[model samples]
Target: MNQDEDAAPVEMLASLCEARGWQYEFVGDDELTTEIQGSWATYQLRAVWRSEDHVLQLICLPDIRVPDDKKAQMYEVLALVNEQLWLGHFDVWSNGMVLLYRHAMMLGDDGLLSVAQAQSAIETAVEECDRFYPAFQFILWGDKSPADALASALVDAAGEA
Candidate 1:
């Protein structure tokens, strides 16, 4: 099968689960279920609606399970990079939830942090990625590193605060 075909399962599953109030959980490629969490902070994805009072395990990509809710403004950010970054498929476990790191960073593109919390959140996310997403690296602001143009944008955003 081609890349598209391999990637289809995760995308379709995510879309279906999202439509039915089901959340995605990232587990390794196996039968047993495991809980995945961020390496940096106490961040975990949460299901808006519990599936039978139990979290569902989904086997797909690491970044596939980012929370769909919270920070209404972040949707624009996520949508902007969907093509470049989120094109791959991931496995999600059903019993896992995402934790929103209160003190995470937000690396922006303007070489200035557009938001103060961006840095902490970014750090948290990076750590989370490191822990659960070793194969997949975390890129902020289009750059391939922890500190880059996106970090600056995050600073700029925080300056407004």
Candidate 2:
């Protein structure tokens, strides 16, 4: 699609969320916030459209806090988790308590953000957050090392029937 024919990412995302019956709100012309409910936690995701740069940034904040004392160790766990992740990386706010997972996609020259693409991005963020949340819990509450925490979290025991 040509640039003029491209649909705005914000509009596409909003429509996708509405069709899915997900709650979302527009923080600005180019920014939106939505929530995803997971088995472990509810994640708040914010999407920002950068028209000038042709990029969409998705940030996910799970409903958990890293204690101040645990922030250093959390960073270590995040580094290990990020290494294994293909899309997003874990990061802590400067306050050292708020944890976030972030991912970004290039909009390409056409700037056409498809419904499938938006759904995929949202699913990825929610899945990643749910997958790594237990590791962070292990680090903060179980006194597990970064490596051990990640290992435990990543172990998949479910088998095919």
Candidate 3:
């Protein structure tokens, strides 16, 4: 796929969300950027989005020169998240490997449980993982396991928030 081309699954998801009255927007571009966390450091935070109750995000880097198999694994991890979780009421935020899970726990503009909250929950999740583990490694070598690990991490982080 072209660095600028979004995966087909994401496009389909976006269409589905739109059909359901949710707005799907993609953010960011194919610009080279530094990986603030992880070995094999340096990547691009390619895209982001807002769904009805979730924040959608994508990042792709054709550089940093990792093995192709590893990159495919990382892509799988992202695909799994979008398929199983992101299409729901759970609000999400992401910048590539760093996915922030929040919402449903905050006070609304009217002081009730708001649909949006401080981004700390998601931020802390990514920070904690980045501090203790290697994001690039996960993406490079993380097969199906990475998906599970990420899902657990997000759930734990949201609970903390």
Candidate 4:
């Protein structure tokens, strides 16, 4: 793990999930899936360990769904929500029906994932998804403007301290 080499970071994530008592199951040799219950909603999180690139991607799909009639507003909300985050940005899936938050951690030359690295990626996904669930909801169902939705959610972009 000292440099670019075969890495089993997905195993590391499994260990983390087990240690935290969060139920998760392996998808394959390189990926895993789990649900993280957040304050706003429970989210499905998938972690894919990209061996060649030495990266682990955590994609979090919240319970929010964008109806066809609300796609315009949802697009606006996507802009507002993504601009307010440091770790990840929100995006709609190819189906154009589901919204997801995506964040990635580069394992660097070592291709190793530390506990903090794994924890950060997982926490970032859940936290961002939870934080903006209401904003998406406001846009999708409440007939609220993106600005109003973000304002109501008290969301502002994070800057480094």
Which candidate tops TM-score? Answer: 2
What's each prediction's TM-score? Answer: 0.23, 0.90, 0.27, 0.88
Measured on C-alpha atoms, candidate 4 has an lDDT of 0.81
Task: Write one digit per residue (lDDT tens) for candidate 1, span 1-161.
Answer: 22232122223334333544544553432112212344433224321212233222222223433344422223333333232232222222344532121221122232222122322323333443333232222332132333332344444434653
Off by over 4 Å in 4: 1-7, 155-161
lDDT of 4 by residue, 115-153 (tens): 777777888888778778878888877888988988877
Which residue ranges in model 1 land beyond 4 Å of their true spot? 1-31, 36-38, 41-71, 86-161
lDDT of each: 0.31, 0.84, 0.36, 0.81
Ranking by TM-score: 2, 4, 3, 1
Q: Is candidate 1 or candidate 2 better by TM-score?
A: 2
Clashes of 4: 0
lDDT of 2: 0.84
> Please, what are the lDDT tens digits per residue for candidate 2 over residues 1-161?
33233368888888877877899999989999998787698889899999889999999999678887888789899888889889878898777478999998998887768777887999999888888888988998999999988888877312212
Q: Which ten residues in a row have the lowest lDDT in candidate 4?
A: 152-161
Name the weakest run of 10 consecutive residues (lDDT summed) in model 1: 98-107
